[model samples]
Target: METDKKDKLIIALIIGIVIVLSHNFVSSQKSDDLVFENISSSLDDKKQTKLINNNDNKEKNEKATIKKIHISGEINKPGVYEINDDYRLEDLVNDAGGLTENADLNKINLALKLEDQMRIIIPNVNDKDNNENNMTSQLISPINQNDNKKVDINTADKSELMTLPNIGEKRADAIVEYRQKNKFNKIEDIKNVSGIGDKYFDAMKDMIVVN
Candidate 1:
């Protein structure tokens, strides 16, 4: 009888041990699965972050490659101007020394796109005596003209020559040089400048009088 009881107790203990081991095994497997899932999620987040950073770097590099622009002409102050790729004409004008006293705002379309090494020429005000020498210069045409005559570029001073449309210090100088070199044969001889085209000549034809 005692042997039977001992055998029964031994069987019960063995069954209890098997149940505990099975439960622990299942719990361990669940823990392993949870750990693996967490690792995968972390890796995915890191990859996304890397991709975003790479895109940002590419954008920055593209912006760095864009070149700046420079401009010069009859501005309040004329000089080399450094402008960003997206900069507008108005912005560039402000950068390269603002408009000069006689700068004709109408002559320049401020909305124009700026190009590299582009020369911007600001025209003198119409019917105005304004010039570089005077920023606050006012428009005042020669009130006293000889009867039935107008001003002559061949003999006009720096200030007087500017009264003609598109005539600036540079053009005025060219006129004087041409007059001295070849001597004025006729008023039409004033077209030797590098920039003076037929259109400009037509505009100034009436304003100029050969002395």
Candidate 2:
């Protein structure tokens, strides 16, 4: 009877140890699942934050970036320049130092869109060859022909005086200085200069006069 009691006591102790170990194992599994869930949530939040930051960066870069344009041909200043996306043709013209005095603004479409390496051509008032020829013809033609034997250097324009053969801006200017200094009495007084001789005076004798 004593042996049977000892066997029962040993079996009860073994069963209590298994129950305690199983309870601890279940609690450990729950704790591990919660830790994994927290780690997964942390990783997801990091991904979302990174995605948002990238989008913000892209927007900022787009706003800060400026496009450069290369323009040439017939502008006042032709070269490479940078302009914002909102800038227009008028703004570009101003940045390029505006147009030349001879530039024909009426012929071009100033409101047209610009592009990279674009050639902005401000055409001449007329066709190139025709314009040049017209200018030459106008230059050769005389204006208000003087019939008397006098030349008024002070009042006459440089172009008018330069119409004489072999006369240039410098020589015309010299004649004006001579007239101013001596207050010419006759047309022969112009012969005092080195380049202007009696022959040159005779050639221009009919073309000039004085009051």
Candidate 3:
């Protein structure tokens, strides 16, 4: 009877040990699975943060960009200059190596605020009066005797300008804006009015006049 009792006790101890080990194994597996999930979530969070930071950087870069302004005529270095949008005309003049000794500072206000796509022309001090006379003369072109072939752009409406070849509504409106700020002294002076270039002027040269 004692031998049977001892066998039962031994079997009971073995079964208890197996049960404890199985419970511990299941708990350990659950802990490892939870750790793997937490690590994956952390990686995803880092990637999202990186993407947000990149977008913020790009936005800052776009806002902080400089503007383009064209500077020509009578400066030591006359060319297209890229400058800060808030910069003044004085700053742009200095950038172009100040001005030539003969430049007529009286003609322009250096304190004028700068804008994109602006063109500045520095006049000569000595010949300024003579140059003024020449400009007036160009504006007074006597119409060609032939059936009024030349279009007087200075007095022409937008519709009249659009009648010329290569001069669409945009170019025609640009002419009006330019003429508002600057009197077209000569028919050729239209070339200096931003969008009108050599090709466009050449295309409409024979068909246009200044008066």
Better of 1 and 2 by lDDT: 1
lDDT of 2 by residue, 1-211 (tens): 9999999999999999999999999999999999999999999999999999999999999867756665444467877788777766678888998877776565555565554433343444543322332332221222233434344654676776676543566667777777677765666676785556554454455556555
Give the candidate order by descending TM-score: 3, 1, 2
Candidate 3: count of backbone clashes, pairs at least 3 residues apart or interchain:
0
Per residue, candidate 3 scores C-alpha lDDT tens digits across 1-211 of 9999999999999999999999999999999999999999999999999999999999999767856665655578987788886788789989999888887666666777776655555555663222342332221122233555668889999988867654556667888998998988888899987656564465467778876
Residue 133 displacement in candidate 3 (angstroms)? 15
Residue 55, candidate 3: alpha-carbon lDDT = 94
CA error at residue 58 for candidate 2, angstroms: 1.9
Against the correct fold, how does model 1 do in TM-score? 0.39
Give each prediction's root-mean-square deviation over alpha carbons.
14.2, 18.9, 11.3
Candidate 1 per-residue lDDT over residues 14-93, each given as its tens digit:
99999999999999999999999999999999999999999999999987766444333446665556666676778877
* Error at 182, model 1, angstroms: 16
The TM-score values for the models, in the order shown, are: 0.39, 0.35, 0.48
lDDT of each: 0.63, 0.62, 0.70
Candidate number of the best lDDT: 3
Model 3 global lDDT (CA atoms, 0 to 1): 0.70
Which pairs clash (backbone N, Cα, C closer than 3 Å) in model 2?
Answer: 150-209, 150-210
- The candidate maximizing TM-score is 3
